[model samples]
Target: MKILAIESSCDETAAAVVEDGRTVLSNIVASQVEEHKLYGGVVPEIASRRHAEAIVGVVDEAVKAADCTLDDIDAIAVTYAPGLIGALLVGVNFAKGLSLATGKPLIPTHHLRSHIAANYISHKELKPPFLCLVVSGGHSHIVEVLSYTDMRVIGRTRDDAAGEAFDKAARAMGIPYPGGVELDKIAENGDDAAFPMPHPHVDGAEYDFSFSGLKTAVINLIHNKQQKGEEIPVADICASYRKAVVGCLTDNFLKAAEDLGYTTLVTAGGVSANSLLRRELERLCKGKYTLYMPEKSLCGDNGAMVGSQSYYEYLDGNIAESDLNAVATLPIDQRGF
Candidate 1:
């Protein structure tokens, strides 16, 4: 099935056309980083406005790149949940408009589920009934992928997510907007053991995570150094903070994978694009289980993943009505249509 998908859940406004979910015919994205950089983070109103301006051109380009028109599309898929409401509404409503004009069925896609489906584009051999670790700007979840359209969350964060922790720590260090990527880049030349950081202990829930304490510890470290008139070791701090976060993530991920007796371990989301994480996970999963990580191109929010996931929903005969609404706090399991 040929699926055209739209994604404006966050900063990027993207559209893509995919054949059978795994084969991407075209993936076009308009990144809002430069627009949001001046503010040190994404502004919802600005993001939604940008999506409105770029949505049409983005989808048009996607179709052109795919060498197909809307008539070739079997369904319209869009991200409608767990994102900025205004931003999501831009995509969802635009998709609804397109579906109405083109007479295509609408398939509502979950934000996190789309992240997991990104693996399908990169790893063609990947299948369901495996463990998946989802780490992104707003979420961190350990999911059991029972099938393309069916999944169960086994673990989640109690407070801030891993990516949020990284960004907050880097912002405190005076790094620019999208600080997590910069922090990871700076940590390369430094020693992770230069500073002391503790791993969080989640009582009663082995797979559960807590990164707020770690983020607070970094903040206090910087403030104390400033108070003492001591220069901050940015590289060393980045290394130490990253090491702590990565350590906690990997430990829990592996434990869940092992306890579940799953030999296939997959990862998704923007945070999974971290070089340290990719290397560390590979090291740990060596000789123990197979690993799947999406290409860097599919790491962040994009329409391709949505298109990929929509195929499964279409296969399951799930379609949305014209009244489908954007949900800001939708859970992965709800999957309302």
Candidate 2:
């Protein structure tokens, strides 16, 4: 099936065309990082306005790059939930209009699910009945993929998500916005053991995570050093902070996989791009499970992943009507187009 997918979940305005779910024909992502960088974070209003401006061009470019038109597409898939409401609406409403105009079936995709589906694009042999760890800017979850359309989250963040913690910690260290990548680079030159940080392991929920405390701890450390007139080692701080975050994520994910008896592990979402997280997961899961990680480009919000999951949704008879509306807080397990 030829699926045209739209994604404007956060700072990225993206569109893509996928053939039969796995093959991405064209994935065009217009990142608003430059615009949001000045503010040291994404401003919801600015992100929404940028999405509106970029959506049409992005979709057109995706279609053109795919060497197809709307008429050639079998369906329209769009991420409608678990994102900024205003940013999401631009893509959702545009998709609705496209569906209305083309009379194609609309498929509503969960933003987080799309992140998991990103694995399919890179790893053709990766199928269901495995564990997936989704660590992104706004979410951290360990899910069991039963099938293309069937999944259950086994573990999740109790407070700030892993990627959110990374960004927040970097900002506190006076790093740039979208700080995860920058922090990762800086961390390479610093000692991971230079500064010890707390890794909160939620007691009852072994698989669950708590990063709010970790974020606060980093902030407090930075403040304390500043008050003492001690020059803080930014690289060391980033390395230590990343170590704490990655340690918790790796430990919790491994625990979930072991408890669930899953031998195949997949990691996705924006934080999947973190060098430390990837290295640690690979090192830890090497002898225990077969690990799958999405390609660097597929780590963040994108339409190809949406199209990949949308194909499964379509196969499972999950289709939406023209009047389908964008949902701001849709649950992961709630299956509906």
Candidate 3:
């Protein structure tokens, strides 16, 4: 089946054409990083307008690049929930219009599920019944994948997500907007043990996570240094902070997988692209777990993963009518239309 997918979640407007859910014929994304960077973070209004302006052309490019026309698309898939409402509405409405015009099936997908399906694009051999850690700017979760269309969240953040913590910590250090990547680069030169950040302990939820305290600790350290006219070691702070955050996430995920007797461990979302996390997975999961991570390109929001997931949603009869609208706070497991 050829699925044409649209993704306008957050600041990225993306489109992709996938065949049988595993092969990507074409994938296109127009980033709003430069525009959002000016504000130190995403402005919802700006993101919505940008999605409106980019969706049409992005879809056209995807079709052309995939060597197909609208007539060749078997299904139209879109991320309908768990994103900026306006941004999501643009894609959802555009997709609805296409479905109306072409008489094709419209499939609704969840943003988190799309992230998990990114693995299908890279690791074709990967299947269900694995433990996955999904970490992004807005979410941090450890899920047990029971099947392509079935999953159970085993652990999640009780506070800020790891990516959010990184960005806030970077801002505290006076780093630029979208500072996580920059912080990671600078952290490569610092000592991880220079400042040992404390790990959070959830009372009874051993697999749960908490990064708010860690984020505050970094901010406090930076603020106190400036108040005392002390030099702030940016690299060391980034390194130590990254280590602490990565350690918490890694530990929880590994513990969950071990407790559940899962040998295959998968990671999805933007934070999965962290160099430290990737390195640590290599060192720790070596002889114990088989690790899977999506290609860096798929780590961020994109349509290919949505397309990949739509195939399963399609099999499960998860189709939507023209009246289908966008949802900003839809839960991931609510697969029903």
Candidate 4:
């Protein structure tokens, strides 16, 4: 099936055409990074406005790039939940309109679920019944991919997510917006053991995570150094912070897979693009289990992943109604608000 997917979940307005689920014929994204950079992060209002302006052009580009028209698309898929409401509405309403005009099935996709599906694009042999470590800006979860549309969260963050912690830490170090990427680059030159970091544990929940303390610790350390008229070792701090976060994430991820007897492991979402996380998983999974990771380009929000997941949703007879509305938050296990 040919699926035209639209994604305006955050600061990116993207569209793509995917065949079946694995083959992506075309992927187009319009990013608002430059505009959001001035604020050191994404501003919801600006992001929504940008999405409204770019959605049309992006979908057009995707269709043209795929060498197909609306008539050739079997379904229209869109991210409808767990994102900025206004930003999501742009894509959802546009997709609904397309489905109305083209008489195609409108598939409402969960943003986080689509992130997991990104693996299908790169690892064509990948299938369900695997463990996936999903870490992003707002969510940190260890999910069991029971099936294409059915997923269960085995573990999750109790407070700030790994990506949010990274960004906050980078901001304390004076790094610009999208701090996680910059911090990763800086961390490469420093020793991870240069500074000590906290190893937090949620008393009752073995697999659950808590990063708020770590984020506070890093920020406090930076503040103390500045107050003492001492220079901060930005690289060392980044390395240590990254090491701590990666260690925490990998510990739970591996434990879940081990406890569940899952031989196949996958990582998804924005933070899965982190060098430390990828390297650590690669080293640990070597010769023990097969590991799958999306390409760096596919790590962030995009339409291809949504399109990929849409194929499975279609197979499961999942379709959206005309009154489908965007939601600001929804669990990965839940379909809609």
Candidate 5:
């Protein structure tokens, strides 16, 4: 089945055409990164306005690039939940109208679920019944992908997510707007053990994560150095911080795989693009487990992932009506429509 997907869940307005579930024929994204850079982070109002303005052109380009028209698309899929409401509404309403006008089926897709499906696009041999570490700016979760349509959250964050923590730490050190990516680049030149970071533990939940304390620790370290009139070791500190965070995430993720007897491990979302996480996972999984990660370009929000997941959603009867609305927040396991 050919699926045309729309994604405006955050600062990106994207569209794509995917065949079946894994092959992406065309993927187009209009990013608001430069606009948001001035603010050091995403501003919801600006993001929404940008999405509204770009959705039409972006979708049109996607269709054309795929060498297909609306008649060739079997279904129209859109991200409808767990994002800035106004931003999401642009894509959802546009998709809804497109479905109505074209008389195509509308498939509502969950944002995080799309991240997991990104793996399918990158690794055609990948299938369900494995463990996935879904870490991003808004969420940190370890999911048991039971099937294409059925997933269960095995572990999650109690506070800030891994990417969120990365951004917060970078900002405290005067990093640019897309702090996580910038931080990762600079961290490469420094030692990972220059500064020690607290390794937090969730008392009762073995697989669950807690990053709020660690984020605070990094911020506090910077503040203390500034107050003492000492030079802040930006590269070294970031390296240490990245090491700590990666350690925490990998420890629990690998533990779950070991305890649950899962030999196949996958990672998705923005944080999975982190060099430290990717390298460490590769080293750890070398002999014991199989590992899969989305191509770096597919790590962020995009329509291809949504289109990929929508194929499975359509087969599972997760279609939506014209009245479908965007939601600011929805659980990963729930249907967006």
Candidate 6:
């Protein structure tokens, strides 16, 4: 089945056509990273305006690149939840209009679920009943995929998500917006042990995560340095911060997988593109479980992953009506309508 998908969850306006969930005919993403950089982060109003301006062109390009038109697609799928409401509405409403005009099925997909399904597009052998660690700009979750359409979030961040921590920490260090990638690069040349960053180890909730304390600690360290007029090693701070986050994330995920006896481990979302996490996971997880990560491009927000999950949603009778609306704070396991 050919599914045309749209995703404007945040700063990116994307579209794609996916065949049978595994193959991507075409994926087009127009990012507003450069625009948002000046503000040091995403501005909701700007994001919404950009989505409105870019969504139509993005979809047209996706269709052209896929070598097909609206008639050839069996369904119009879109991410309708867990994002900026206005940003998401542009994609959701555009997709609804397409479904109406072409008389195709409308499939609604969750943003987090789409991230998890990114693994499906990357690894054809990957299937259900696996453990997925989803670390993104707005969310951090550990989910148990019981089936393609059935997933339960086993753990999530109680405070700021991992990606949020990265961005905030980067801002504190005078880095640019979307600091995660820049911080990672600077970290490559510095000493991970230069600064001591706290790792919040929440007891009892073995699968849950907390990064707010870590973020605060970094802020405090920066403030202390400024007070003393001490020359702060920016690279070292970046390296140490990255190490703390990666270490905590890797440890918790590994512990969860081991405790649940899951043989397949899938990592997804924007933060999954981190080099340190990828290397550490590969180095530590030898024979214990198979690790899967999406290609760097697919790791961030995209429509192909949404289309991939939309196929399963269709198979599971998860279609939505034209009245479907954008949800800014939807849950991972939410079902019905």
Model 1 ranges with Cα > 4 A deviation? none
lDDT assessment of candidate 3: 0.93
Q: How many clashes show up per model?
A: 0, 0, 0, 0, 0, 0
- Total clashes for model 6: 0
CA shift at 2, candidate 1, in angstroms?
A: 0.8
lDDT scores of the candidates, listed in order: 0.94, 0.91, 0.93, 0.94, 0.95, 0.92
lDDT tens per residue, model 6, 267-333: 9999999989999998888777888999898999999999999999999999999789898997889
Q: lDDT tens digits, residues 236-275, model 1?
A: 9999999999999999999998888999999999999998
Error of 6 at 50 (Å): 1.0
Q: Model 1 compared with the native: what TM-score?
A: 0.99
What's the residue-level lDDT of 192 in candidate 4?
Answer: 92
What residue runs in model 3 are displaced by over 4 Å at the alpha carbon? none
lDDT of 1: 0.94
How many times do residue backbones clash in model 1? 0
TM-score quality measure for candidate 3:
0.99
**Model 1, residue 16: C-alpha shift (Å):** 0.3
Q: 1-337, model 5: which lDDT tens digit per residue?
A: 9999999999999999999999999999999999999999999999999998899999999999999988899999999988899999999999999999999999999999999999999999999989999999999999999999888998999999999999999999999989999999999998999999999999999999999999999999999999999999899999999999999999999999999999999999999999999999999999999999999999999999999999999999999998999999888887655
lDDT of 2 by residue, 1-337 (tens): 9999999988999999999989999999999999899999999999999999989899999999999888899999999888899998899999999998889998988888899999999998889988999998889999988988788987899989998899888988889987988999999999989999997988888999999999999999999999999999998999999999999999989988888899999999999999999999889988879999999989988899999998998898888887777777776878544
Give residue 170's lDDT in candidate 3 (0 to 100).
96
Candidate 5 Cα outliers beyond 4 Å, as residue runs: none
Give a tens-digit lDDT track for model 4, residues 1-337: 9999999999999999999999999999999998999999999999999888888899999999999998899999999989899999999999999999999989999999999999999899999999999999999999999998889998999999999999999999999989998999999998899889999988988999999999999999999999999999999999999999999999999988899999999999999999999999999999999999999999999999999998999899889889999999899998783
Mark the 10 consecutive residues where model 5 has the least summed lDDT: 328-337
